[model samples]
Target: MSASRTERLLNLLIALLNTKYGLRRSELRQKVYHDTTSSEVAFGRMFERDKGELRAYGFDVETVTDKGWGSDDPATTRYRIGKESNRLPDVSLTPAECTVLILAAQLWEQAALGSAARNAVRKLQAAGGLVDPELPPGVQPRIRPAGQAFEDLVDAIHSQHPVTFSYLAGSTGQEEERTVEPWGLGSRFGQWYLVGHDRARSDKRFFRLSRFTSAVVVLEHQTFAPPSSFNVREQLAALPELPVRYAVVDVAAGALLGLRKHARAGGDADDTGAATPVPDCVDRLRVPYRDAETLAEELASYGPKAVVVAPPALHAAVRRRLAAAAAFAAAPFPPIDFPRSGPAKRTRKRTSEDQLKRMLQLVPFLVHNQGLHISEVAQRFGITRKELEDDLRILICSGLPEGYPDDLLDIRWDDDHVYIIQDLDLNRPVRFTVDEACALLTGLEALNGLPGLAEGGALESVTLKLMAAAGEEGLKAAAVAGPDVAPEDSAVLETAREAIRGGAQLRLSYLAPQRDAVSDRDVDPHRLYSLDSTWYLEAYCHSAQGLRNFRLDRIQSLQPNGRPVSSAVDPAGGFPVKLFTPNDDDAVVVLELTRQGAGLADDYYAERTAALPGGNHLAEVRFGSADWLPMFVAQHGGSVRILQPANLADATREWLDAALARYEDSTARQLD
Candidate 1:
């Protein structure tokens, strides 16, 4: 960095300390830039340079000492900026982009702490010296992980090795030996589990981490060794996240699906001549953005086109997730009398009626274009290059969960001047297609139907997209936006969330399906969560007197009427599947199969059976999941089942029984 830039970096630190954390000079350097080692050889005068740069950037830092206490300690010096920090970034952003960054920081704050998150608080805190850093008091503890074990598992997933731990069965109270070569870890509802090959058991398995006594890295530095012929996600995505489809997606000609798709390699059926041509129907079709939200959005896209043809087991799983998600979203929430409208007045006085030109001038870049320069951004913004280095510091701090989560303001200033990352047509209007409006309405409607307590969350995300599609008028349009709301139900959920966080006891009306009656009770709501699109309050139900599932849809009303308790709340657990599939005689129900499903059966699930009976038409298969028998059958489509007992057949029949009933019920309703 140049001498001037270096000096500005120091001043930036001083301004940061004075405004945000209230740091004193000598102590501030020790916290961030100072070397902790006692050795002096590697030291530099970072502190002195920082002080000199602060003055040059037009920041006046005053040093003060309180004279009293012990006479010896009277000689202390602390820094407080004259009138906030002068270090702002030179780059510019439209008010909307700046708004998104702020919302992202707020919405993503907690996720950033997750090991899976690429951005984090410590990172933002280090660079956002000139921008505002405080989150509104109401928005603490952003989005809570459904469970902590899932969080820890996600943290460990980016590694290659066998996870060692003691796992106990919830009912049997028996612990077993397990050494799993983890492939991937995923979360559902409120728990986390790992999918990998287990050398100890000689099979592929899914084990929940929350049920373990201890979780540790027993070994490290293992080869990723994805089976030369498999697709992992397609195999594991059997339930909640997406529909496991069988229609042959056109794999590139001559390209083999990665073998790692199987847990480990089920059999020699991982094959060739039987390979079919990649169909032209889906030949590199357009896919939506590959961001996290895309995964959730899939539920809407794959609704009826992707059918679970044969295995009754897979069918139930899909229905349950959707029904559960729908049931959850359509449920009731705690009541609140949210005001009928938004803020009645702007926080600031209306400066002028000059329209677009005036709003553009308010943009940081346009207001200060003279001093903006690529190299001198540090000097003009009064921030260190590193602070304003990556993204615009002004935009970095602009989100509000305190308001709607997605309200966006594109504020950018770059190169020590106001420069936007992308141009937004503030001068033009936005028009939406009928389909886009339908999609937008559908998403908003989903929010409107959410568990009463969390209904607002869904709407907030919808409003954000709407504003983005609304074009030029933006905030001016937000002022006129309206949809009548019955605030009573939503009020309850908010109060419940508040009580849960504040440690307050709640009085509520709960309906239990098993009993089919609503009862009044007092309980402690430990956490609030949404899974499969429905909202739920996880708590120690004093009525059940144990950790129980209370659907938000069934909740009638609620309020914080009791004191917060001091006890800790245990995290949610996963649904267990007791079945297995192995690659050899050692497993149950062996079958010769097509080369298609071999990688999944052999490699990951360890259910690979022996070689094809004739090495010409089929491959072998084995797997274990007592509940999955029918679902497994459905997934294989028309594939042959070599070992079928009266029980497995009866199981498939049973699922059809339930499904046919549901189908019949729909028909009856339509006829009415």
Candidate 2:
């Protein structure tokens, strides 16, 4: 069989590392490119490309020439990666430190950096520097990078490559093509932004990831150097605050109470030069807003119940979004196959890049854990024994250009125990990638704000240790990124933590948004966790007689009732993978999600899903109460539409129609 590029690269890496005086172009061609290349030009191109690939993987391949004879020739140029430069430096970490690091690494959740953080922790484990320590129960903090654009920009920044994308200009509200030398990505004011040098404008620009209108295209085979002292946080901090504006909206008297609470009870005159009279069963509100786009989305979610009365721009924006949503919801869709088992588990294809990354980490791991059982190694790397064996086979044939038995890596599995007899200079873990470092550091910083976690200055100590080990450049690059987590009310959060630690039954005044009512309930606190910056307490509600997740912000008043807890529920076992837990009695609602709303399938814990034409999907989801369905439909605009459970769909359509009719009546009055 022909050797794959991954195998060839591994062979080349092995050959380059094993050399003392470095290997010349001709020697590398003979050793690494013998079977792959047909001519000298092909060999040269392949070798150069491989060198860059290795460098991209964090290996610094040094170039040298023999000037000892006082005769410098371009042909004498040789290349090799020094062990000292490529290997990670030794750093001592306590069990507590390792535990904190693990927690930090696990914070990426579903972002692209999640895998990188895991890989970083695995390397630490392989080196025997990590220890398993008990984490705070139910406290899983996660940060999700905005989307595909964030991942692409991170990669581009790491490779120092330029990127091109279509960006929606905030001022003009039009999408324009932009080519930028991506310097760093950071989060500020609950949004992620890319700080880069705009090629067309010839100046530094900070772009919000949310404003991106198209997929980011990384210009490979081209690179540019960013400013030496560039820092993402500093750049973002220097940004000017946007001027705040006000919008007048007319909402139903009893509905949308949350919106009403934040707004004042008066409105300005309408565009027709007359005082806007509040319609019967409606309340006019003057709401302060900074971003029109954000406000439009929020208002559109109210569906037909809320209408902008003043500021033509705001009204037009809200109307446009609602019109789009109503059009999409009213559109006919193909019937979906329902009442199926569930969404089929997706199988990810193992790519060559993935294998290469695994092998690079595997070498140092096996070196540290000699004579480990073969199965254990496979399990650790999340691969099968056969795959591990194939990787071993490839490595065994890879070595120095000498082509001697001693030059190759020695391996044996005589008793189902794998051992690496020789690993050359690849016996130490590689340095952390930029993404991995940023994920860990940012997570650690976030942990500092969480009350119960990181006691005894462990978070700070760990941060110092990591910064010292990561060096200046790594630290600088990592600083280009930050996590955006909203600060929870400290007094309320501390009170909740105290209750959970003390194992007490708590009496609480909680506002249920779905029901739009505040009710007092007795509950035993189980665990406290946050998802997407919103803190939720999973508790055994005496009233509900089941596990219920209550948002911390909605707790009108929380104080322990000074009673011992009676619920014998296991706190560790009940932590949900998602916020909502489906019950048999819950209503099953089928939804058709546009490409924009596909993420809702995962967010809502869809039981079954099937892809439709044009990137739309049919999802079967469970709703504990159908009362919130109309608001859910409106909140997401046209992206989410009810397709099944005719009664619920009809109710939602009726609600939208009523809201739209109110707006039309108001428009007719204005025309008159």
Candidate 3:
């Protein structure tokens, strides 16, 4: 047997990383372990072991084909250590920067995003610059998406392997065995979905993670090639588009601006190029929409500020839903508590091949939650007791350079309780993967958006400190040039954050999107959150007399009302307003891009884009609203042609004509 697989693995890594392109199998054997190549069979076995070991340590050995750039043949494939993935830039984080990173990590605790965040923090700690035994207090906000199927689905998606899982079909409401070639995984509207090619039905399908009734079983023997043009976002855009229809509605003054802000919901100005004045403080206007349900919900949120007039169907639907809600509230019903049934499934044990980060995470958790029962700890970590025990054994055997008894981790445990009795320095901080670093960086960016922090100067300063720690190579991999936050928006965010912290009420001139009007309302700012690249203030509004979510961008003006707030709501209590959910049934509209827009092929929805000759491109952009398609086309500045859904082309022309009239009117006024 070889003396140490670790020594050989390190030698192999050095050889691979040093190479420019990659080494062939023969070249790898000759360079790394000359004795193994004495026989072809022995070399093959050694190479396989080394490759598997590398992958286990988080290195993906990418393969390149000999048949030129576009060839799909695996037989001609040669392997190389992916340069970007193979290296981890040395980071030296300042204490303040480490604190910021810690806060960022805490933000996603117990979240689907937590896995990446925790691992990144673990790596940062492993780098040995700033150290904290536990996360700081008062920074625990989690957005946890519950599911066990997500991991299995992700695994299948990565391996490009077909998986069989019993899914609770939405249409039938029964569990059915589905064999799908997993293509991509995405999250929208706070739910995870697996978009894949269903082999059983010979069609692409979206499987919600919550719908899985059984564990996803990856079929090891079956593998499939994903289409080159497959894009998860494009596939999700299949929902039905709303048909174009104009509805006459009456709204309060200044509400039109609010409505226009969400022009995607069909904001149309009247012939006067302004809102139509109506009776009783309401201004009449024509709004276009495809989705009656969503439009109704938006209008209802405005309370009595807006009224749906024409389009009897939409008016009736809104009235009916509102009436039913009132009736339900007026009626009394007994609360029934349903008992949970079925025994819990046994947890799967982890093998040595699993990433060691999980073990690192377990250490801190166990240390903090000391005296917890063994079973309790296992449940907390989402692992079986046997698996936890195995991790414990592994930790006990791991230590510093000498590999002696005192240098190793002193883990004390019994069947009932587990505890760590020695110094916490035994566990070397794990290096952050690129994705992990990006997640943490994005989180820091989110925190940086908030104002009213006294301890830290600006979030930007903290980010700079982190970037310095991450080194040059790390920045190249993780840095993103995101859209700049508007100065006014940032000011509003700061003021609102202060109001929330001080428990003070604010008099804010806010645009209610549903009402299509601006109104001054006294609000007790509760908390601030960002979604879809926009900051939102969740506050208790005194005007509508309810809790509402307000976009910071729509806030015209904000002033301190001077009155102390009566109550503060939990930051995570409000409903997550989904901006959009692409339905799998939406009509796909293909657009032929001119040379001007051809370069944007990569920027467009991935699954819907295809390259053509002469630097032209065709994209099947998703549109569920009659209003969205025309606007999308107009925004392209005449560089695109709507090829499918002939009706869309006509709609685009109508929108263009309307725009031209507005511009003509503006020019005439200027001349006068």
Candidate 4:
């Protein structure tokens, strides 16, 4: 009544034409008009008038009143707009978003970190109407290049077109001739690099397109063999953070390097071979691997030569192995377990109704394969259609990522029923593999044996289901469930789950190993988080006057203490977790070591090594935290030297002093 309903009909018809099917008059009336029942006669008159008007605008509205084509369903009478060859409607993304998406596509086309970048690229393509649904968020590219070369290269690579270009290799003012078979593209070290087979060398090589002169595709045909079974991400991630040798690689030097020259893995050479002085053909060791064992071995080979850069875990592992080798040939034996201590111990979150409630609570999303019918889902789960549909509805709405841009509810609906939009087979459900099932079942069995968990049989059922899904082979892994971790001493964790449920405060004596102290703290427990097989109470901690991660394994004692937290507390803001606590005095303990030390620097729990010297071709590792200092020191076993910071130096010296004191006292006693 307010606007021209006739014009609106034509517009709707135009939009509908893009889909595979079309609606008849009554269906159109039902979809577009709020009260279509009353407009039945008017709707019919408008439909014919609209068809005539649209035909004038060059829309071919073919009528189907003839013989076999006549609709028996009666919904085919409405005129359908022929496909629009002129233009498509504008998409939902802003220009800025579109630009980002295009760039993401550029990155996607050249990505070696395939899975990691897949979603972002997919989402970008989705925004560009290239892909469907969307991908989740991920770590932003640390290397943000402000050039269009990356984009252009992606197009050329994807199109499989040939491009002529010149690239400056080094300071010799020499330009090499190269025609390449583009394999992939990737970003590294704040610049973009392309991986392709060098036509000149008959080998795979990397080219920095930004450095190439007159790089443009002149070839029209796109035909080339893509590299088989090669992952770009793995190759690129293998690059060293910093070079031990010169960043530049001469033919002889590169050939001598032990690290394999992956198409795009490294930016500089290592100095592992640099110390030879006489300079045999090459001047560096090969790439330091990410695998803990391989990295340990590599670091050991370097002994004191290679420098490790990037990622804390790898560095720690190398340092750990080196320290262990220095201290002892074998790992220290585990602490002795006391005889069947107290009564039975229960699982932290092992409950039936609780698990069901959680499942229900988290059900709204996670359904991606949309083609599954409700009946099929019911059959697969051996449940009634009602229950299955309810589960599906929950999955249709359930997920994290606040508000739900990433929510997996792609259900398409007509006036009568709902249909999930899936391109693949809907009958198949996402399931765990044999190994994964085994791991899950093992965890489930461990949970079953835990104290308090015996009261709930849900975990057992889940385990059975997982095993059944994986079949007999999976049961073997589950059967191999081994010894459980002993409960931590000096900390008795009592989860305040009931307290949070019933609105009560908990009194706790938490062990603070940093200060070698255990203090009484009052907490209003809200939640319990299970991470890496340990429970932690996430609640309002009154001891620190804030929230804290109270390790369930580390609770020395627990009792009822205070009332529920209610004083205008922010639900979102709470105590930030420090990875580890410090001991008595803060120590700026600097560790001086070889390139292996540089590699090991990544494994630190605290801040970075200050004054990192490339000059020495070694790493100066520093630590200032007290948390787990003794344990960390013990693990390292003394290949590392404490450079400065008086207190930590004293601590190191004190360890040596105590060892010396033990030896002297033992000798005296023996001599006497």
Q: Write the per-residue lDDT of candidate 1 for residues 1-672, one digit (tens) a residue.
A: 443343334334323433432445445546444448643333335555555645543345565655543323412655556433342222223333333223332322222122211112112222221144332222212223223333334334433445666675434545776677666554333334567787887887766554454435446655444343232333445635433322221222322222112112112111221322222322211122222122222322233222222123333333433343333222332221223433221111222211221222223332334335645644433234554443344333332212232332344543345454321221111132222222222223223333332332434553565445433322222111111112234566577767866878888887653243569977776655442233566666676565544556678778777566534555433211112212233435433333233323322232223333322112233443345444344333223233334465455545534534443443353345
TM-score (all chains, Cα) for each model: 0.27, 0.84, 0.43, 0.32
lDDT by residue (6-98, candidate 4, tens digit) is: 325323433345334455566556554434456566766766676665454334665444345665435544345445321122234433333
Query: Each model's number of backbone clashes?
Result: 89, 1, 15, 32
lDDT (Cα, 0-100) at 158 in candidate 2: 76
Report the C-alpha lDDT of model 3 over 388-423, residue by residue, as the tens digit. 787787666554323357655678886478888753
Instruction: Give the range of the ten consecutive residues with the poorest summed lDDT in model 3.
Output: 477-486
For model 1, where is the 10-residue window of minimal lDDT?
477-486
Clash pairs, candidate 2, are 304-659
Highest lDDT model number: 2
Computed on alpha carbons, the lDDT of every model, listed in order, comes to 0.38, 0.75, 0.55, 0.41
Winner on TM-score between 1 and 3 is 3
**RMSD, model 3, all Cα superposed?**
17.4
Instruction: Give the deviation of candidate 1 from the true structure as CA RMSD.
Output: 25.1
Ten contiguous residues with the weakest lDDT in model 2: 339-348
Winner on TM-score between 1 and 2 is 2
Give the Cα error of residue 44 in candidate 2, in Å: 3.3
Residue 606 of model 1: what lDDT? 26
